[model samples]
Target chain A: MGIPYFPGCTLHVKAKGLDDSTRATLAALGLELTELPEWTCCGTAFPLAQDNYMGMVASARILAKAAKEGDGRLVTVCSFCYNVLKRVNFALKNNDEARTKLNAYLEENYNGELRVLHPLELLRDDLGFDSLKTRVDRKLKGMKVACYYGCMLSRPAKEMEFGEPENPALMEEFVKAVGAEPVDFPYKTKCCGSYQVLNNYDLVAGRVKDILKAARVRDSEVIITSCPLCQFNLDWLQDRFADEDKSFSKIPVLYFTQLLGIALEISVAKLGLDNHYVDPKPLLQAG
Target chain B: MTSEEMTRKVKELSGQNPYLCMQCGLCSASCTGIGVMDLLPRQVMRFLQLGKEEILKNRSIWMCTTCLICTARCPRGIDIARVMEALRTINLRKGNDILAPEDVPAELLAEIPQMALTSGFRKLSA
Candidate 1:
């Protein structure tokens, strides 16, 4: 049986590599991700205002549709989708007034039973880290990867409830299972200026500079993240920051799934590993 | 809006009692966007408590990424991010959008993830 999956907009477009790698990684672990036949965007931002039911519509619809389809769980790849979907589910489950308004607006009886999950959480809970190690055909023995959690997967602990929300070890443990060294950095859970990147480029570049410096000083070879926004900011902005200052070192940012795909003996080309801005191929070969 | 009206409106929208803040400054100290915000998270909380309408005009409201670092670290358990969102809501509901879709560059539109565009629209628009 295939598990229902919701691939948000970015996964099908700019973050296709993450989507592809996630599918391959899960498949290698003996689970197939079945995409929802009719899924929409999770509105990206979970309306922070208590009354913004319009913002909750998209995510509530997703939760309702998934539950009505006879599945209590729906998994998505990107951290943005996971955050919105998860928070919306939490909000609807807790707030009776908002749930009623949203249900009436969408004209769907969403009981808020559907659970939202990211692939990392799924892998950890479903297949133990040791089980993951057993499936690794190729071990990343000499590689040192920095697991960048960023702000999405680690924020609003009362709402997101993902990982430690501070010193998340899920990605770190996953790195160990893949036979790689996990470098710890304080900036791992820091915000990368997120949506501000589209407007405040210099501000985001400054953030990227700090994150890269912290990780590099710790001797991390490659930085891995589950969010495409973080991957893009670190990967694309690092190149720009490096060009402006010769002393600035560039680091390749890879999706966690891409790293998992490598350990699963999936081809880099098939994972679209070459599509990164910093060119992760050299480090893969080095490891 | 009257001072009391503003206070009530924010309380209604955010569902957070701004007065719970002890002015410990942990929220401001831990804020990720402190470098860009005109008023720190703690200051925003204080302003919210005072029902100061001027807080709505500040850049601090726009700069908040809703990262919730402040919320996670607040000693008083005050959800500062929600307060910031309430201030943003007050401003945005006035039809004065912080970010217009046309203002976004084509280069960014082409390269950035759609999530960026969607979040920007959701947060910065009315």
Candidate 2:
């Protein structure tokens, strides 16, 4: 599958492992990821919620650049980027007033049809999951992981839907392909309270607590997720939440691709597992 | 608010069945961060139903994490998260100062660059 890779804001920084492991895994499957040089943020949840025009302009700006780079399809690691970019692009295509306004705002008339794809979508639709199954060097066995989709991947247009929205099988399939047992957890597509971290720490803390509590009760060794915000809320905030509630545990929250890379026997150091707030070693070793 | 207008508005906001809400408190009960909220998830829906634009514009909407727990727990299959997004849209447009102008608040901004340098989330939005 051919597409320019947009790791967005989070994967390059906090969830760098996701980008690294994804690139490696895709390479194993014979796919190339060309990151957009000087790509901007998707303008995240705020632009769309506040101003559709701004959201369209922000996404189109990125697409216009990608168009200039001569890549029509963009692959994103973050669910937020995938959702926002795709929705904005969809708006640009369907709404002439939107297109005109956004084009005017961007100072470039973008007629380019750019398809925003999630990395998992490319893996499943373009590369084929069966091929991924063949590349598994180490199968994660008996390790129950909660496949957290958060908000970005499956919502709006189901931009990267390889499975059900309420009950997803895409991430689960990948987990199983790597040999780990995907647990039936309640909070898979649930929000990590991604955008709320800025205003409501207490609420974010509660959401994290619930996610971890669900994982713990389900006997999950680790939690696997796709979005950077989800990773942040679920992983880094665990300690603070635990301190707040005493009962919360630092359940190693991992970027989903890291687990796949490890199971694929890809180098862990390069995967950036060390960067996570909750160390995944205990869970990885235990499994 | 007219019933038709309310229905259209809710559909525009959440893309779910507003009428589906059984008014069962499961959503509010299961809300992880309901205590910090001025109007709970269920209340958000009720306000939408009643066309309480002011309540929809309140700072509480911005406080929501868009955690679908409330929506998931809703007996009527009402998507409270989408409603939260709708309310967030309204709050943001009305310039309700929930957090700082930046998605990351000012107090957190000092640590953001350092955290970004080490953690990587800062670069995500940059």
Report the Cα RMSD per candidate: 1.4, 5.1
Q: Write the per-residue lDDT of candidate 2 for residues A14-125, one digit (tens) a residue.
A: 5677788888877766778888888876665523232346545666888878877745788877776776677677767776877888888888877648877776777778
TM-score for predicted model 1 compared with the true structure: 0.97
TM-score of 2: 0.80
TM-score of chain A of 1: 0.97
C-alpha TM-scores of all predictions: 0.97, 0.80
Best by TM-score: 1
Count of steric clashes across candidates, in order: 0, 6
- Model 1 lDDT per residue over A238-272, tens place: 77777788998788899999999988889877697
Alpha-carbon local distance difference test for all models? 0.85, 0.68
Pairs of residues at least 3 apart in sequence or in different chains that clash in candidate 2: A9-B124, A10-B124, A13-B120, A14-B120, A140-A179, A193-B65
